[model samples]
Target: MDGCALLPVNSPGHLPSHHEVTRFHCHSDSEDEYVIIELEDLENLSVAPDKRSSFEPGSNSAEATAQELCRAFRKYWLQTDSAVQLSDCLSSSKQRSVRKEEIPRELESSLNLAEEIKIISKLRGSSGWSPPRSQIIFNIHPSVKRDAVVAAQNFTCVGCGTPIESKYIRRLRYCDYLGKYFCDCCHSYAQSSIPARILSKWDFKKYYVCNFSKHLLDSIWQHPIFNVSCINKTLYTKSKEMDRVREAQEQLFHLKKLLKTCRFAESVLKEFEQVPSHLTEELHLFSLDDLVKIKRGQLLPLLKDILKSSTSHVDGCELCQAKGFICEFCQSADLLFPYQTAKCKRCPECKTCFHKACFKYGGCPKCLRISARRTLSETPSLVPQ
Candidate 1:
């Protein structure tokens, strides 16, 4: 029930006038005039990256203060049911008389009872509720003593070598039919004691199942029962890994079976044969002597023709030109501007129509660039794949 209170920084109206005046004075500091910029209108305050520091300090102390305030408020807002159950346990313990030496024992019991009560109370408080039985035997069977049951069962379940969790017995009809000191749920579900001979059979069964699951590479090792290991954790890990290997083996076996059924050997070979073994690349080329090189008259006409041909063939924006790239931000493309694709990607400048990809070039353009494609249908040719 013990808790603390905190006054919210934003809830200044609830505070006395003196406290409010103090807060105002702290914020309205004149000595540190440069640090204190008056945001008369909070809306006018710029959240731009450059202007942020003048407002919020962004410090650890500020963060811690905010967290502490939240915790204090949460304490006031939330109510837990344990407060009532704790009171009940203490009251019950007070009514019981005990010897001086037994005081410690009594206190321990009370603490445990309080814990159980708290659990139940919390469960009931939740929207969907379920309850466990009121009585729980700590270490011994309800009807049998620890040693007697262990002796009869040979310190292990006759049905399975898995040892019982605890010697504590809970009294119930037909419990003796099963070997003594079985886990409560197991005892109830099985409805009889497991005999020593039956336990040996179970051991054999477990060994076979465990080995099979491993050898076959089954995913069954994830089960909770399989998780319980007789050996140390290190060995248990090795055991599970073995299971995974077995699962892989099983998968391979199934794949083989599928392959056999599908007659993969015959079809697989045929498919391999169909793949091309070699590629041919040959093109006619003119001799260097025959290649016409240079006069401006011929060059200009050819250049113009080439540009016209490129414009008709290329698909790009009229504004940017299909020069081989386009600006991402502006998304401009044309014959003069670059056409953009993965390997040929470029960014076109806004005003100058400069391709950002062409960083080697200095500021001024040597010649004007032109558009390539006016429309999608006007796209000339698909590049060879």
Candidate 2:
């Protein structure tokens, strides 16, 4: 009378007398003996074969239904007997098992069952549920694939010598010269700029020499004249003493070719011719005797000076006129004395000329200024207001 029993709700006379019953045993806290009763398999009997197949042990829907049934049974049982003490039967069974390896297998099976239940719950709807097409659930984390790639490759950046994160591995580049992978920072420097000055000569030769010609050409185009003033002047003088003129001459020949290729040779030669002999005594290697024949080593400094002075003079000459054969200062060609009308006025003192507009603006070289001032003081009425 204290035990529970399950009986079929409706039994017909035509039905077989022998029906299957599943028995379960439970003991009260005060009693040592166990009580058992025949229980009808309500789920097997009420559910159709096709419907029951969906809740089989291997199916996700089955796992979900089983969990729901367990919860409902526990709730109903607790309602019936408030004094009944409930414990986790599954955990107790696991603790009682002696096989260590079997315990891990059981835990893994439980985890799989829980995962299937979760997946089934997500896929379930009012229209009824269907098994997910993919058996393995894909992780939604954005970095999952990237992390897998990094782990598989075990990639480390050559530049920083650090393990590269999976997300940043795509940003790495390969350098043929160094024969290694480089991070963004080092790869950009290698591709876009010259090797750092801190790099040793051997390293420069090894890692940078392959692209030196390109870098040199780019530098020359950007800045036509190479400035060597930063170098020790004594080095040049010492080379001359050592009779390394052949090397210097060879370099000069190559330099001339470069200037000519860049369409600067003619202008550079003309500028060199105008330079004073005294000022170039230190750079005597670039003698004016043959402007066409000079070493680039000697011409380098002169070219820098020309570019600098030309830029300054052009900027300073506010009244500079268009280049022509007419006199810049007088702006007159004496038809009566055609022979005396020189193409340009060469100031004796400064060896410079002033355009007519420049003369009007009081921009005449110092040598011509003294004579003009004296003449102006002599004939005040002739001076324009």
Query: Candidate 1 lDDT (Cα, whole model)?
Result: 0.25
How many steric clashes between backbone atoms does each model show? 42, 4
Model 2 misplaced regions, further than 4 Å: 1-225, 229-235, 238-349, 352-375, 378-385
How does each model score on TM-score? 0.17, 0.18
For model 1, how does the per-residue alpha-carbon lDDT over 159-189 read when each residue is reduced to its tens digit?
2234343433232112332213333222323
Inter-residue clash pairs, candidate 2: 252-295, 252-296, 328-355, 328-356
In model 1, state the lDDT of residue 304.
34
lDDT of 1 at 269: 25
Question: Among these predicted structures, which one has the highest lDDT?
Answer: 2
Model 1: residues >4 Å from true position, as ranges?
Answer: 1-112, 126-254, 257-261, 264-385
What tens-digit string does per-residue lDDT give for candidate 2 at 300-381? Answer: 4554565454434333433221222354456565211111112323344564544423343335546557788898888759
